[model samples]
Target: MIYAVGDIHGYADQLDRALALIEADGGPDAEIVFLGDFVDRGPDSKGVLDRLVRGQAESRNWRFVLGNHDRMFLRFVTEGQQHDDRIKSGLSWMNPRLGGTTTLRSYGVGGPDSPAFQPPRGKVVETLVSWWTNQGNLSDQEVIIAAREAVPDAHLNFLATLPLWHETDDLLFVHAGIRPGIPLEEQEEDDLIWIRDGWLEDDRDHGKLVVHGHTALDTPEHHGNRVNLDGGAGYGNRLVPAAFDAGEVFTLWPEGRRPLVPA
Candidate 1:
C-alpha cells in the first residue's frame, strides 16, 4: 500500500506522529507521498524541514509536492519577495493567522523579546498590524536578511527542487486540486498549489484519483474523484496520513485505521 500524508505546516511533533503511524502501517520503507506546505504557520518549520531534508538524504521512500506557503517561505528567504497581494499588503506572511513569524522564530531570526515575536493581542496586535501594513518594506528588511542567513543552503535547495506533482498508475498526488478538464501535464503551477474555487467545486473526473491537501478540513474527505487529507495541521488540527490500495482509502490514526468512504 502507498501512503499519502497531509500538509504538515511546521508542527514537528504532529509530523512525527504521522510518520510513526505510516511506519507502523507500511514499515520504514513504505512508499509515501507528502502533500506539501512544510513551512509556515506552526512553531517548528525549521524542524519540519530538517526532518524532511534528512529523510530525503537518507533515501527514504518519500516524495513531496510544493505548497503555496512553502513557496512563499522560499521566495521571502531567497529574494525578500512576497507573493499573494493579501500578504504583501496586509501583515504579510508574518500575520498571526498565517504564522510565518513562528517559523522565523524556529530559525532564530527573531528573539523572544523582539517586537515581531510579540503575541498579537490588544494593543500589541494593533501595533504589529500597523507596523506590518506594507510588507517587503525597509521596516522588515532586517527580519528578511536574518531569515536568509539563518536558513540553511540544504533546506533551500530541497525547497527549490520540490516537484509540483507526483503520480502513479491509479493516483495523482499534488499540494492542491488540479484544474478540471485540463490535462494533468498541462495544469498550471498556480492551480496545482493555490486553486480552490473552481477546482474544489467541480466534480468532474480528471483521469486519476487526485490526492491533495491544500484546503483544510476537520477530517479527511473522500469525494469519489479525490481524497483530501489536509485535516488542518497548520491550524492546530490533526495531520492525517492516508493509506490507499485498490481504490480504497483509509486514514492511519493512532488508534487504528479508519476507512474514508466517498462523500
Candidate 2:
C-alpha cells in the first residue's frame, strides 16, 4: 500500500503521530510519500527536516516531493538568491505586508524583547544558523557552522539539491497546484508553487490525482479535479494526511477533527 501525506510545515509532533498511524497500518513495507512544504511558518522547521531525512533513510520505500517552500529553500542554495527576491521584488514588498513581520515577531525576534532587527542579514540566516544546525549530521557540525557563517551562498547550495516533484500511478504530488491547461512537463515551477484561484477554480483534469498543500486552505478542499491537502496545519489548522491505494481512499486528521471522503 502507498500512503501520501499532505504539507507538514514543521509540525514534528503531528508528523510523528501520522507516521505512527502509517506504521500501525503497515510498517516499513508500506510506501510513504510526503506531498511537501516540510518547512517554514512553524516552530520547528529543523525538526521536520530531521524526521523526514531519518524516516527516508530508515525506510527504503519513503519518498518526498519538493514543495514551493522547498523550492524557495533550494533557490537560497543554488541561485544565491533570497526566497522572496527570487519570487519577485513584489514578494519582498509583500513579505512585511503578508505577516512576514508578524511571523518574525512570533519567533521572538523584532518584538518587545527583540535584540536587533537588522534588515539584509535576513530571516533565512537566523533560521538556518539557529535551527537547522541543531538537527542533522553531527559530523557536519563544522561544515554547517561554516555554512551559516557564509549565509546566502552555502545555504543556497544545500537547498537546491531537493527534488521538486514526485508521482505514482494513482497520485501526483507537488508543493503547489499545477497549471490546469498545460502538460505537466510544460508547467512552470512558479505556477506550480504560487497559483491558487485560477488553477483551483477551473474544472479541468491534469491527468493525475494532483495532491498539494501550498494554498493554506482551512479544509482539505477538492475542486473535483485535484485534492488540496494543505489544511494549514502549522497555522493552527489540523494536520492532515491522505492515504490512497487501489479501491480505497482515506484521510486522517489530527485529533479533535473529522475526516472527509473525497467528493
Candidate 3:
C-alpha cells in the first residue's frame, strides 16, 4: 500500500501522530507520499523539515509534492523577497494567518510575529501612498540571513527537490488539484500548486484519481473522482493520513484502515 500524508504546516507533533498511524497500518517500509505545505502556520516548521530531510538521507521510500507556501518560503529564504502581491500589500507570509512568522520563529529568528510587523486589518486606504504606508513591514534580509545559518542546506535542498505531482497507475498525488481537462504533463505549475476554482468544483475525471491537500476541509472528502486529504492540519485541525491500493482509498486509523467512501 502507498501511504499519503496531507499538509503538515509546521505541526510536527501532529505529523508524529500521523506517521505513527501510518506505521501501524503499513510498517516501516511503507511507501509514503507527502502532499506538501510542510512549512508555516504552526510552531515547528524547522522540526518538520529536519525530519523530512533526515528521512531522505536514510533512503526512505518517500515522495514530496510542492505546495505554494513552500515556494514562497524558498523564494524568501533564497532571494530575500516574495513574489506574491500580498507581500507588497502587507499580508505577508509572516502575517499570523499565513504563519511564516511561526516558521521563522522555529529557526530562532524572532520579532516577525510582533504586532508592529503585521498589517492592520480593516484599515481603509485613501490613496496608493497611504496604502503603501499601511503595508506591514518586515525585514526579509534579517530573516533570510538567520534562516540560511540556522536551516540546514539539506532541508532547503529537500524542499527544492519536491515535485509538483507524483503519479502512479491508479492515483495522481499533488499539492493542489490539477486543472481539469489539461493533460497532467501539460498542467501549469501555478495551477498545480495554487489552483482552487475550476479544479475543485469540476467532477470530471482527470484520467486518474487526483489525491491532493491544498484546500483544507473539515474532513477528508472522497468525491468518487478525487480524494482530498488536507484535513486542515495547517489550521490546527487533524492531519489525517491515508492509504491507497488498487484504486481504493482508506483513512489510516490506529486500529487499522477504514474505507473512505464518497461524501
Per-candidate alpha-carbon RMSD to the true structure: 5.2, 7.2, 4.8
Candidate 2, 1-263: lDDT as tens digits: 57777777667787887777776666657787787777656655556766776665576687776776666544433343333533443342113322222322322333222122224454432221122222332222332333344334322433455566787776777777787877788888777667776776777767777877788888677655677888888576767666665635567543322444556
lDDT of 3 at 132: 11
For residues 9-119, what per-residue lDDT tens digits would candidate 1 score against the true structure? 999999999999998988989999989999887889999999999999999999999998998888888987644543333445666567677788788766544244343
Residue runs of model 3 more than 4 Å from their true location after superposition: 83-90, 112-140
- The whole-model lDDT of each prediction reads 0.83, 0.59, 0.80
lDDT assessment of candidate 3? 0.80
Candidate that scores best on lDDT: 1
| TM-scores for every candidate against the unseen true structure | 0.88, 0.71, 0.88
Model 2 per-residue lDDT at 257: 27
Worst 10 residues of 3 by lDDT: 125-134
